[model samples]
Target chain A: MAVTDEAIEKIKGMIVSGALRPGDRLPKESELASELGLSRNSLREAVRALSLIRILDVRQGDGTYVTSLDPQLLLEAMSFVVDFHRDDTVLEFLAVRRILEPAATAMAASRISEQQIDALSAQLDKLGDSPSVEELVACDLDFHRGIVQSSGNSVLCSLLDGLSGPTTRARIWRGLTQEDAVSRTLHEHRAILAALRDRDGEAARSWATVHIASVEQWLRSTL
Target chain B: MAVTDEAIEKIKGMIVSGALRPGDRLPKESELASELGLSRNSLREAVRALSLIRILDVRQGDGTYVTSLDPQLLLEAMSFVVDFHRDDTVLEFLAVRRILEPAATAMAASRISEQQIDALSAQLDKLGDSPSVEELVACDLDFHRGIVQSSGNSVLCSLLDGLSGPTTRARIWRGLTQEDAVSRTLHEHRAILAALRDRDGEAARSWATVHIASVEQWLRSTL
Candidate 1:
């Protein structure tokens, strides 16, 4: 494991130092091993591990290459690990989302097109007053995602995407057991939508903070 | 690779569904492979990959087990991936930090201990007026990290830590070549420290935004 880790660092160092670049094919396994002063097996293990994380691409007979290293591809590993987090970890993710979502909302306020705002409104309309836990959870995810995507920062979008996964289950659990979960969430979404429609960044930010905080507050009291 | 990915998902599904939990030992290799309906070889590959990301722990002779799934541990994978990001990706990270650091500084303002504020003051003092590029870079990281840590959210701290890595290099480059880099950053740190000392979340937040924005602005113009 240590040898493989070292090899991984060497390969990553090459990327950081601009010796290897995105989409560049790596040298043959044997040659890279010698260049990095590692045994071929360790190098192969390192490559495999990195490939698993979407950092490297192993195309079978075509040879290994550096991935595009796009924020979406690299942060995919985060979504995987997020699934493993216990319920307790949700609070930490929420703390982060509280800071990010409101800021993202503010950015979106000025940038979101009329079409997008209409789509958001249409989305809320699709969720009637009394939706099931599953339906509510799906709508909730889409609503928050729509606003964050409008922020125009892919990294923020990806980070929030990863953070939102475990909480979606929590939201479902809340929707099933908590009183007025459906109506309360829908109401908050309506408030946030109005702010966005007004192109009021401050109001949008405030509404978003209030919206997510309501969920956090509920989680706190219930937990 | 596809088979290994499937095996990875199966193992992750177990964790997510609470069939397997943090620090839980797996059944012996053969039994676990059978349980997941995976070949032993594929299971081993999956485990190796997970271990690389700190999601699983592989003991030399002891059996493999799920790791604690701590935020710090899981997010370590992020730092590794962040290293592979292209120069343009730094902008995305900066955008995130711009949102997060201000919020984090605000949280820190009310919560930061007097001792911590003093420590930040001392940190700034150590940089002096004309520190070297390397010194300025290191101080710059520690200064921001100190405020974020005071926010008391490990996830936010880790995310910011990972985002700061490549930008540290950029800072060093700028410090070496740009005019008055050292004095400007030091002056900003002093302003943030003063706000933190006053327990003024709004001021702390504003100062943090200005401090980070200066760097972002520099990167925008230069990059």
Candidate 2:
């Protein structure tokens, strides 16, 4: 292994083995370097790498500490990774989303509070009809995010959030070229909300599926 | 942004914008650092961080280059992140897997070949009636992974692989403690394979669901 990678794995061993619990500040650089038998430079590089992935937090003028290691935080690194996906793979990403979002929506159906449903409904109403492509894209992200959050599974919420990156551009393009796409999206959102309001998991799931499937179908034809 | 973060974002922008295509060698460190207006140290740290996530490949003697950025390679980093998940969150991870693995199984039913089915059946038969906990755990991973791979979505396959980390220990615990767990798992695997053989997507999906739900149920009761 490379020196830096070795340094990284040692630190990871500490975290995973519970030697360094979340929010625990590290020992001084010199002490840790000696303790791990790594050079200071290799240790610094490893810390930088871990921080990039949200595994560590390097406070200015303070010691480095482990983050909460929450699924949401850890998986946020995935959105960064997903941004680099090739165009050919966007459909695959969308297909995965098609599987996940509907399940999340269905889960939300059983657990989503009436107030949460109203909040979602209000967010849609605030968008009104005939919004700009940018507005629609932003609302679309928030709309699904709100619903997925209700699924009560942080891992699911984070995975769906991470997987949405590649499809964002597809949504913008669809909204721009497909003239009726805006109205169709709004209509679908309302249908999904209605299903959630009625606590109909199957209906919510089906609506979510077709909603993403339409985007996938449109992108497929265009591609 | 921190200097290293700015440096990382600049490199990421290059890749995402098509300037730094996959497998493209990065410019000489000094020259690229000057062009990007970054100090050598920041650039190096950024390269190290990006390489840690499989975004950039650093050759010891050769120049650093962009990786394939394949979803599989990119999301492999997620498995690393998934390792840090807390005990309380294992159920959330399992819930996401339950949603994904079933869909992947259903997809596989339509696309999996007779040859692949034979391979899976052969794998099961090789495990024999009695096996060690380690063997059971390894076979269980390969079994679901084989089915998910047949699902024909690399993103889905990678995400499922990443999400399996937390549940791995859970599987081992179930295998070791529950007397019927091993037999039950073997039976379920056969049922899943039979569904695939018959090309019954719904049946395949249900078997996959119950397969995971049983593990979830066991883990829930234990927890």
> Model 2: chain B TM-score vs. truth?
0.95
Which segments of candidate 1 are over 4 A away from where they belong? A17-21, A24-44, A59-65, A166-179, B17-21, B24-41, B59-65, B166-176
User: What is the DockQ score of candidate 1, to 2 decimals?
Assistant: 0.63
Against the true structure, what is model 2's DockQ? Answer: 0.85
Cα lDDT tens digits, model 2, A118-164, are: 99899999996566767777888889999999999998998899889
lDDT of 2 by residue, B129-219 (tens): 7787777878888888899999999999988988886445544355455568878989999999999999999999999999999989988
Model 2, runs deviating above 4 Å: A166-177, B166-175
How many collisions per candidate?
A: 0, 0
By DockQ thresholds, what CAPRI class is model 2? high
lDDT of 1 by residue, B1-223 (tens): 3777888888888887888888999887788888878777667768878988898898877898999888878887787777777777788888898989999999999889999999879877776566667777777778888888889998888888887874555543563465566567678899999999999999999999998888888778878
- lDDT digits (tens) for residues A43-82 of candidate 1: 7767878888888989887899999888988887787777
TM-score of chain A of each: 0.87, 0.94
In candidate 1, the second chain superimposes onto the true chain B with a TM-score of: 0.87
Query: Evaluated with DockQ, which candidate comes out highest?
Result: 2
